[model samples]
Target: MSYPISPPTVSFSSIIFTTTAYLLKYQLTRQYSNARMALAPSAPAHRVVDVISYLAAHPTVELSVSDIARGTGLNRTTCQSILLSLEPRGWVQRRSDLRYALGAGMIPLGEAALAGLQVVDELRAELDTLVAAVGLEALASVVSGDEIVVVAHARLAGVLSQTVRLGQTIPFVPPFGIAHLLHAPDGTIDAWLDRARVKFEPDERRAYRESIRFAEDRGYVVVLDVEARRRFEQAVSELADRPASHAARRRRDELVARLHREERSFGPWTGSESAEVSQISAAVYGHDGHPVAAIGVHAQPHQIDPSRISEHATSVLEAADRVTARIHGRNPAMSARRPTRHV
Candidate 1:
């Protein structure tokens, strides 16, 4: 159920959500960004896409041949073959030490990639305005594979220091990423739940199914449990350099152990007068009925009066809608109140 939180003033400086001839453009734009970063394990052209994506995401580090093979789930021979073909073409550079990285040939391609981020720049500006207006830390991210990668963030010296670094990936596992998975296609949520790092009782699983949809309907997910969220963020902040690293896997396990213990932390708000919360995430979508990004606003690390929860959510949801409007997005009728899996 929606909470009785009071609305905030100055959530936006004369923000308006109106447009046309915008929907089609956003569908294409969303597709482009997803292609750039969010290929699932089962994506096609695995030999090329998986290796290229792994290298692109980890451009800061040079990797041994075995490292690339392990990271991309490719066999050693296939990985070696792909690298050999790409090294001559300059897409892959064999370092003096025999490790590899994106080569100079990727320079023009990288420049083009960065230049295609006008949409991301717009989202960043909007989030900046949002953080300033609400006086809270804020971030926006999009789904990539089985994780959400932070693309933009803004913070003030108010509540807490930044926990998760930009570009750090959070697993799309249960009890997290509810906001990102809200608009997922049929059965996708089921797959996510089935693959959860933490085990859930049947009751808990059923409730999560409903809660995700309910949040979709309300346009926001109230992130309660201050200490739990901080712990989760801190663990993520300390994650290994690459998500495929052994340390990262251990950290993901920590998320399930330390964070998911509080099964009561999320789900439909019970209208409690005070919520021990750290953030509230608002849903965002594209015109094609698929989610394009995730957005959230942070609050002080304490119990927030339920009325203040309402106030924070107003600004958060308004900012979300404005971002969608900027990109010509809408909640498709079919996706509304629709369950991602048949429970």
Candidate 2:
């Protein structure tokens, strides 16, 4: 039969247990300290990110101090204090009705931050896939200090003459440059044109005037360039018919032929000794529904003849939507060479 342990033995066991508990506590405390130290330098950016994340989750819903506090699990006073800090900077707005939403001023800052993050790599990779699938070229360009920088690009192997490279500057300003004008007030673009010493050809000038008026009317701009818009239209048109109708296939073939013709007229760029290049474009808006940037494609003219771009328009649009998201600071765009999650 077993007997109860003596008092001294029992005391020894209790001492061991206490020592083990203290050791574990020490280890856990040290680990937590290290983690806190690592995060300290990024605290402010983290807080701004937190604010942005909160806004993203609850867009278009009017938020109050208590609502924000409860949603973020912070104290009401703390929430109000943060909002106050954001207000003057135009990151958030307090309306006359006492409701709050994102501020108009926050847009550029958010866009700047998003651009700084290099999310465009993700977009380029996706575009590369599209190029292979469509047997054509896809590209993204950004306006950088008097040059259009082709930051991310993909092209089909069989096609040639696409000499565009990342970091290379194009003298021609992007058609979407008009966006800066639209976002500003009263002759801002005209003044900018004068300041930049830019002379617009008569047709180009008329086009810009017409485009700005049209964008204002529709609240957004969509380009119908041969590469992007034509492809999308072709895709939609193809989908309109089913079971591989002969008439539909014939129409698709015709559209593809048209794209080839456009490419030849537009190109000397695609290095192919034969099969010239064509391009198409479009633009989209933000949550506030403001036109942000233009999105489009460039491809070999012959590729357009089969309307092969239509087969890949969805991917092109997905990239464009991501770009639009970046414009509103919702996420990074593919053109910015930053890490962007798919929209």
Candidate 3:
């Protein structure tokens, strides 16, 4: 005869404690796994932003999935998925050749970003006044990181004008960029120059130093004539053409050296002939006493009589001051100072 076998008994409290412990352990493991996934390289949002940024940086280039993968360092499959997803939303468009580019959807986003800038809003009326008083295009720009971005502009009616698109990034070079550098803190300027690997010749370096000093003293920077403008454009074009490689960087240094040489020789102008064109730029300081933006006036000598450049410059300087005061919540009248004419 066999004795009946009974199962080992467990206490109700023990059972309850074991079950609760298991549940807690499971929940903690799940949370840890989720956090790891969120920060992983394969995170969906990170991949999407990487793809978009790659396209934006090469706006003119229509890139295939493989090209984007290589550029953004994402796997081809992920890049393709992102591109396909973005196509429906209009964030990225597919060309007939099946390459991708930034699509129409980005415009509204860019407009919204521009609308959010207080500086842009405050400068609108001042820009209009500046355009009217100087009879030229008036622009307000800010240094957004390492780039100069045009935030607002105004042009007088019934006059031919050059339209600088709002939210466009400008190359950090002379004429337009000098105002930013002149007013930037010393550390920022040094870091920017170092990143560019700039090696300036003695004379070119001296001229560059003087230009900054001149801008600081006069409260504005002037690009005297049309020829200087052409040179500036040419240098910018050359710099853009070169790739960001070691060899290209070497050539860039050489080109930058040449540009500085030319700029130093073409010092600020007090007056010009009736047919010449010139630019005046003044810094817009924030409440922190650091330059947050710059205001510029572009005038042909015929538009403003050569004798009246000083008056036009004064108007530009006053506009900049007014914007600065507005940013700091100070009275514009209390901040008024005599404009220092750049000779």
Candidate 4:
């Protein structure tokens, strides 16, 4: 048997002295760093960043300097100064009417950022394997600010799955984007719930919160279970499958408006029996531990097979871990085997 190694013991007075020395050193280092910062030229780069952020949020809208200043909470002169600096570099463009909007210069930076993400090809590979194993349409979506964009996918042949388009973007609405939202930074849920067109009831809000908690703890989210869920998924799936004609678009919008006013359809479920499982999603994390992607598998919305729920959740979790490894680490290794399926 291997003996437990013990840490070295230290005298009380020696510990006290060492602590004092460390405290003194820390104070001195902090003071020196603060002094250096104070002496350095102020770049006002943060103000520029805020302005760019504001413009990005309203990408299609041209704003006057005052509008930008109000949005950024910066003074008019400061906003003007920053815009002046940005205009020369083509970061922001001044319209003929003197209004400003985000310029084409940002395109290359956005392109470079997208190009730098070498995960797409690897993510698609993972989705293909996952779809094959789970026999459902497996999709990979990456978070982009307030939106989740489908980047890669593997759809099973002969399945009546909804068509998926690459680069399709969906807002982080309730009963959606939970796989990413569950691991999001604080305030994300509040923002998500608030984004709803209609205010949710207390029970509804609590249920949504619990669904996130379930996904957080269980490493997967179960979307639908009851027969009511089946009907709801069916309606949504029908909308998704609508043709791209103008009449279909208008009709879809009308139906979406009706659905938006209705109570959010999904939340956490607890049962010995299995859920219908319209869709199950697992989170993929980057090195920073923020959710980078969500790997989701769409089940037969009407099927209530209990066994597949457990099996499918495990497969997605494994796919998530492997995708996380390929993108964030050198080797494709999961830190742990997936938890037992039922739990």
Using Cα atoms with residue i matched to residue i, what is each candidate's TM-score against the true structure? Answer: 0.62, 0.37, 0.60, 0.56
Candidate structures ordered by lDDT, highest first = 1, 4, 3, 2
Q: How do the residues 195-260 of candidate 1 rate in per-residue lDDT, one tens digit apiece?
A: 676687888788888888777777678777746566666666554233235565676577666655
Ten contiguous residues minimizing lDDT sum, candidate 1:
12-21
**CA lDDT of every candidate:** 0.63, 0.43, 0.59, 0.61
Those runs of model 4 whose alpha carbons end farther than 4 Å from true positions after fitting are: 1-114, 158-160, 201-203, 225-264, 271-274, 300-304, 329-343
**Stronger candidate by TM-score (1 vs 2):** 1
Task: Give the best candidate by TM-score.
Answer: 1
Compare the candidates by lDDT and give the number of the best one: 1
Residue pairs of candidate 1 with colliding backbone atoms: 5-310
The backbone clash count of each candidate, in order, is: 1, 24, 0, 0
In candidate 2, what are the lDDT values of residues 1-343, reduced to their tens digit?
A: 2222212121211222122122221233232346346322344433444454344334457778777665555567766777888889876788887767766655554344335424354444455554554555666654443434344555554445334333223222324244333444445445444433235566645555665654343222333334542453454333222212355445644453454323223221222323322454334444544333344566533344423333344455556666665545332222332111221
Which rank order by TM-score, best down to worst?
A: 1, 3, 4, 2
- Candidate 3 C-alpha lDDT tens digits along 1-343: 2222222232222222222122221233232346346422335654565576556646667889988887766789988988998899777889999998888766555545445567767876688777767667777787654557666666665554332434334445432477776556777665555444346555655566677776676777766554444544444333333222244345544554455445533355544454344667888877656677789886543344666667777888888888887878332123445554334
